[model samples]
Target: MQHLEDRFNKRFGYPWVFLNEEEFDESFKTAVKGQTSAPVSFGLIPRDHWFQPEWIDEERATQGRMEMKAANIIYADNVPYRNMCRFNSGFFFKHPLLQPYRYYWRVEPDIQYFCDVTDDPFDYLRDNKKTYGFTISFYEWEKTIPTLWATVKEFMNLHPEYIAAENAMNYLSDNGGETYNLCHFWSNFEIADMDFWRGEAYTKFFEFLDSKGGFYYERWGDAPVHSIAAALFIPKDELHFFRDIGYRHEPFQHCPRGEDWMRGRCSCNSYDTLDYAPQSCISRYEKMFH
Candidate 1:
């Protein structure tokens, strides 16, 4: 919290909303509150929102978990992680604590922030008419989402009117929605408009995905869910890449190159940056605008 505050939030003074399945103890709350003067509100996720819906087949979900565990997928056997994924994908924005906020910047613990944010990203989103912004782009593990693209395609067909005419479809599909190329913006570092997620198109899209029970039966992640929604519902110009923000989450780091690196006080080696790596979809993201 202190690292994030010192690097960015301290200057912006944006309020923080923390959500967990269990109640946050006083010590945890105090430690977080001590780092920033901005209002800090911690809320427990609602029971219904954080648990598997009654419609889900528990036996199927259990077998799926076992299969994924044998395959050594990350957090494969963790039920709480699946709940967390589902919550973030379709329910987080509706929480009472986040109701008043139109924009949110997602920050995770232990993540390094190398840049001093000179401008407010919320202001940028508002002024520039952007609905979603991200610092990283990558292809999802295909094994985890083998049926997700088919599900999304089915939804698109059923509700064609929800998709924007000038959307970023090419970024997601190469053969006209027959399959997914797995390109998705990493949602962990997102700064997005809540209104966009709450809108009719995204609401219906989430409903469609939820009905499939993939969050439990398959390890459907929130990153691909949000990325697919943004690409289909939002215009290309409204989707942004925050190249100036130097951030690292474990194996991948997005560091600015050359002059901006020096100006941002970034310590990451540009050569080690994953933005241009083979696994990254960033080059394709750039090509879309050209």
Candidate 2:
């Protein structure tokens, strides 16, 4: 919270809304409050929104978990992780406290900020008509989402009308829409228009995916879910990449290059950015424009 405040929110004064499955402790709330003068609010996630639905077949979901765990997939055995992915995918934007807002910047804990955020990305989204913005893009672990692409293909077949006339399909697939290339924008950090999620296309998309029970039966992540929807439902140009924000979340980081590093007073190595890494989808995303 402090790092975000010093690097960005301090200048923009954007209020922060923190949500959790359980109530936040007083000490933690006090600590976050002390981080910035910006208004802060905490909300407890509804029980139904943060837990697996009763309709899910526990036997099948358990078998799925066992298989992934045996294959050594990260978080394969963690039910809480599935709940998180599901909540983030379909319910976060629907939280009562968030309904009044039109735009949001999702921030995770322990993220390192290496540069000063000079502009309000919320304004950027609104002014420029961009629906989603992200700092990192990469391929997901194929082992965790074996059925996801097939399911997505099914959804597209059934709801072709929802797809945009000009979309970012090329960024997601190498051979038309036959297969998913597994590339997705990392969702841990994102600046976006919540209305897009709340809109008809995405709401229906999430409902279709949720009905499949993939959140529990398979480790379908929010990153891919959001990326796939944005890539298919909107114009390709509506998705913006925030190259100026130097940010890191654990094993990967995106440090701005050349003049952007000097402009932002960034500390991370410019050459180390994942923009062109073999596993990154940034080059694929860039290709859509040229």
Candidate 3:
């Protein structure tokens, strides 16, 4: 919290909304509130939105977990993690406390912001008519989403009218929607318009995916879900890559090069920037506009 306050929130004074499955203790609230003068809100995830739907087959889900565990998949044995993924994928935007806000900047703990933000990203998104903006892109774990692409293809075939004519399909699919090439924008560092997710197109898309039971039967992540929606429902130009904001999350870091680094007081080495790493899809994302 202190790191974030010192980096950007202190200057912007934007309110912080924190959501958890359980009530936050007083100490947690005090620590967060003390970091910045910005209003801090703690929201509890509604029971219905954070639990497995009644229609899901518990036995099948158990078997799926066992299979994934045997295969050494990450978080395969964690039920709450799966629930968190499902909630973020389909229900987070619908929370009552978030309804009044038109734009949201998703931030996670332990992530670093190397740059001092000079302008409000929300203004950039609104003035430029952008629906989705992100700092990093990567290929999804194929093992984790074996059936997701097939499900998406079915949705596209059933609702062709919902797709944009100038979508970023090339960035997602190589065989013309026959299969998912696994590329997706990492959702952890997103600043997006909530109206896009609240719209009929995205709502119906989420409903369709939810009905298929992938959230429990398979591990469907919010990153891939949001990425597919942005790539298909929004125009190519409306999706932005926030290259100026130097950011890092765990294994990867995006350090701005040259002037951006010097002006931002960034301490990271430009050569270590993962923007051009083989595992990243940033180069492909750049080709879409460049």
Top lDDT hit: 2
Record all residue pairs in model 2 with backbone atoms less than 3 Å apart, i.e. clashing.
Answer: none
Please report how far candidate 2 places residue 92 from its true position, in Å: 0.4
Tens digit per residue, CA lDDT, model 2, 183-248: 999999989999999999999999999999999999999999999999999999899999999999
**Model 2 segments beyond 4 Å from truth?**
none
lDDT of 1: 0.90
Taking the tens digit of each residue's C-alpha lDDT, what string does model 3 give over 124-209?
99999999999889999887788999999999999999999999998998877888889999988899999999999999999999
Cα lDDT for residue 11, candidate 2: 89
Estimate, for each residue in 102-129, the C-alpha lDDT of model 1 and write its tens digit: 9999888778888777778889999999
Query: What's the CA RMSD for each of the models?
Result: 1.0, 0.7, 1.0
